[model samples]
Every structure is written in C-alpha cells, then in structure tokens.
Target: MPANRAFVLNSRPSRETPAGPHNFRYVESDIGEPGDGQVLVRHHYLSLDPYMRGRMNDAKSYAQPQPLGEVMVGGTVGEVVASRNPRFAVGDHVVGSGGWQLYSLSDGRGLRKIEGGTPMQAWLGPVGMPGVTAWYGVNKIIAPQAGETVVVSAATGAVGSVVGQLAKLAGAKAVGIAGGAAKCEFAVKELGYDICVDHSDADFGDRLKAALPDGINGIFENVGGKPFEQAMLWLNPFARIALCGLVASGYDGTPTPLPDVRVLLNTRSRMEGFIVSDHMALWPQALGELAGHVAAGRIRWRETVAQGLEAAPQAFFAMLKGGNFGKQLVKLVE
Candidate 1:
C-alpha cells in the first residue's frame, strides 16, 4: 500500500486541545485509488479555524459533526496527481474539502479549479470561507453606515481582519479589539482600522468606552466572553451586533453563559448570531467581490504557514489559544 499521513482526532477536546501525541494520532495508511469521476490530489495548504473545534464533537449542529474514527474535517488546496475525471487533469490546482491528510481523493463534489493570479493557499483564507463570512456579516447583518463606529473582536484573525477592513471600505469608522499589543498594532497599522484596543489590557473596557463615546453603531463579534459583555455597554440605540464565533468558550464542555438580553431590550439594539453555512447561496457573489478587493489591493491579509502535515494539530491548538499571528495554514507537502 502507498503510505499517506493523516491527523486523526482520538477524542473530543475539553477546555484545551491536548497535544497531537496525546489527543491526535498520526499514522500511515493506504492511498486508496480514485473511483470514477474522481481525482487523487496531494495537499499543499490546510486552513485551520476555530469552528473546527465545535465540529470535533458528535453533537448535532448546523453541519454534521465530525464522526469519531474519521479524518478531521478541514478545507485544503491541493494539486491533482492522478485524475479519472475529464474536468480535472493531473497538475491542476484545486480547492475543496480535502481534510487534513497528505493525500485526498475527491469526486468533483464541492471542488473548484484554481488559477495562479494569487497564491493557491488564498482559497483557504481570504477570498474563501473566512472572507465570505466577513462579507455576509457586514453587508447582510450589520450594515454599517458612513460615520458609524464598527468594532470587531479577534480583529487580526482571518475573519475579523476582513470584517474590519470591509467596514472601513464602506466608510464606517472601524475599531478592532484584539488580544495583545502585537495583534492590535497589526489591526491598526496594516489592516488600517481607525483604532484597536488590546483585550488583555487591564483598562480595556475603559479604553473601548472612551474610543466610542457616541456609542457603537455596529459590532462584528468574534470573541464573546468579557469583550461581548463590555461591548454591550457601548451599543447605540438600534445598533446591530453580528455574532460570529465564540472562540473564548468553543473548546470547552462548560456551557457558555448567554449574555444578558436586558441590554438588548433596554438599548433597543439587535444581536444576531450566524454561521457562514447559512449564507451559502450568496457565496458566488460574495467571493467575487472579495476576490476583486484582494486583487485590487483593497483587502490586506497575512498568513502564518506551518511546515508540514505533522504540524497541523499543534498549529490548530496554538491558534485556539491566540498564539497564531494571522490565518494559520499548514503545508502538507512541497
């Protein structure tokens, strides 16, 4: 059998994902032959997101949870090494749900042939799901107006970074709330947010309140623990909050405490939570616009690439802990 390496989730993660050697097992397996209309591809880049942590459990959600003893669910960009489908040929680059493995076989389902105008890894980051999520959150959910103050937590991450920049492009004053000085600097300096507050600062709440004295018109929420609680105080009447992910409590078994609804009622504001899957029908238009922005140099992105497939599990856990600088991509092979 031709051998291939894969990252397998041994068990559901608790508060923190245990090391790969403990919670994840790497093993060599047969490189199963491609069936009719299928292609055998070798992975180059794998996109890691916090939502994957929620999928690790068997619990029901918007999408089917990853089943135990199965290869972990992820999006990958790969080059076709063998093809049985006429639509794809050997040496073609494709992006699809290829999982975390050195080799993947796909039957053309949900696969897109990629071009070389930009880096192939981009299909897994900006101009992909993360970028699509930001577009949906801003245009459909928040709808920030010119002069409105828009804030995004986890601001330097793939999704949040796009959210903030899109808000700026729409003429809204964007403020990002990130984890530390470095992330905050990136958000303000590189991504070009109006201001960025570090959530780790002892006076973070005060700083946020001071930054938005007239109140926030829209908030693209990514981190939902203390930041969500504090953002509530600054929301303008009829303000909209686009709740994306709750990375702060996603990995744990403990129930995430719901934020007080009284604030919503008292301020007459709206808070709506969403996943990208809910807006699938709009993906083509959204991705087209995002791709245009990326190609036009309007949207800036940064990626931290890990060296190999063996690095995915460790890189994923590190990302969950806010250790990654930007979009984390694991390179499976050359």
Candidate 2:
C-alpha cells in the first residue's frame, strides 16, 4: 500500500491573522482500499483560490468552517486509479472537492467525470467554478446590454478575466481593473479589454474616471476596497453590480466600508451578492456556453501553477495577496 501525503488543518486561524504554515500540518498516512461503491482518485492538480481564506476562520459563514485534523478543502482534477463502484471506472478523469491531498477516497458522490475535451487543469479553473461564477454574475446579476461599459476588478484573475471577456461578447466595452502595470497591460492586450486600469497606481481614481466617459453600466466587484469605492462614483442610472468577492479584506478583519453605499440608492443601481453553488440549476447551461467559447478559442485563460503538493499552502496565501496571475493551481502529479 502506498502512503497518502496531505496537508491537514492543524489549527483555526484568527480573523486578525493571516493563515500560514502554523495553521496546517503535513501528514503521511497509509492508503486504504475502497470497500463497496467507492473510488480512489490520484489528484493531478489542486486549485488554490481566495475563498479558502474565509474557510480557515471558525466564524459562521455560508459554508462550514474547515475542520481541524482534516485535509484542507480545495478543488482537484484527477484520474481514478482504483474503483469499486459501478458509476466510476479506472482511468476515468474527474473533478471534485478532493482537498489538499495527493489522493482522495470517495463513494462517488459529488464527483463529475471529465470527458477530455478541455485540458485537465482547465476543469479546475476557467471551465470550472471560477468560470461559472463569472457566468452567473454577468448573465444574471449584472446583466449588461450592448454599447454599455462593464468593469471588473481583479481583472487578470480567474473569474474577473471571464467577466471582462463575457462583457465584450455582450457587445459592451470591457474595462478591467488589475493590480500592477503588467497585469493591466495583459488585461487590455491579451484579454481584449477595452481599457485596463491599474488600481495600484497613485492616481487610480483619476485614471478610472478618465477611461469611462459614459459611466459604468455594470461592474463585477472582486476586490472591495478602493476599487469598489471608486466604481461607485461612476455608476450609471439603474446600473447593476455583481458582488463576487472581497479579497481586499479576506485575511484581515476589517472590511472597508464603502465611502458611500448610498451610491446604489442615488443611481437606483442594483448590487447583488451571490454564491455560485446556490444556483446549481444554472450550471449545466453556464458550463455548456463556457465550454463552447473555450473550445472555439473565443474565451482564453491563463494559469499560475505551483510545483508539487507541498507548495499548495504557499501558493494559497500568495494568491490571496494577489501574488499570482489568473488561476492558481498546484501540480500534485507530473
């Protein structure tokens, strides 16, 4: 029997402190065989996302807190190495919540088989949760019309990149807000954004206003601090805002209060906060459209891959701090 190497939650992180190595402990345990109706998956890639930071806390959230002495929860794309279930077979690739481990044992629940049309890692990224999140936000919450201006923060990231591209496909001007100069350039040149603003710049607000002469018709809010505040100043009448994430204060306890939330009221704008899992009914339709776009080369994506299972912890924190570009993943297998 082979040993399974995994990272377990050693302790819960405080709201004030960022999660680190102290929060987790690596464990090597003997792999056990499946009983009946079970499958063993060897993880090829593990996704590192910002939402994991909120799960580290012991506070009440939409989801349960990550349990201590258990494997850290994450998205994984892997192949079935062993199967005792009729639903799953050996050599079948799958995507599921397999946590931060080299392998996962499951009873075939919550596992979706991969059909090999897209790259394996893409299933964990652009064609997966992140892509679906953007789809739901753009298609449902901040529904944009032609000739409108749509903006997305964290523009070079997994969800934000899709939001910008989808807005463009809707015939709206896609304006992206990213952290550094390089990211801003990539958002415009590589991702086909109309204008890319550098939120890290000293005159960020000035540049943001200058870029939008027609005001913002819709916004996909990923970072909530300065970017959200600045976007408020340009809200068009009856504009819509999709509150996707707040990576700005996910680690720290403080959530920067909007300079004036009345902006929503003032412009009669709508701001909706959504969790993609809550809308499972929309997924098949969403993934179908996204897969088509990706397959046809209309929707492009990028990845920041960390090497080995051990790098998962480091990569997770780095991604939360905007140290990574696009979707961050750890390659657990060659």
lDDT (10s digit) by residue, model 2, range 238-317 = 99999989998644556567668788889999889899999999889998999999999889988999999989888888
- Clash count for each candidate, listed in order shown: 0, 0
lDDT of each: 0.87, 0.91
TM-score on alpha carbons, each prediction: 0.96, 0.98
| Candidate 1 runs further than 4 Å off | 14-21
lDDT of 1 by residue, 156-183 (tens): 9999999999999999999999999989
Error of 1 at 243 (Å): 1.0
Candidate 2 ranges beyond 4 A from true positions: 15-17
Displacement of residue 255 (Cα, Å) in model 1 is 2.5
- The TM-score obtained by model 1 is 0.96
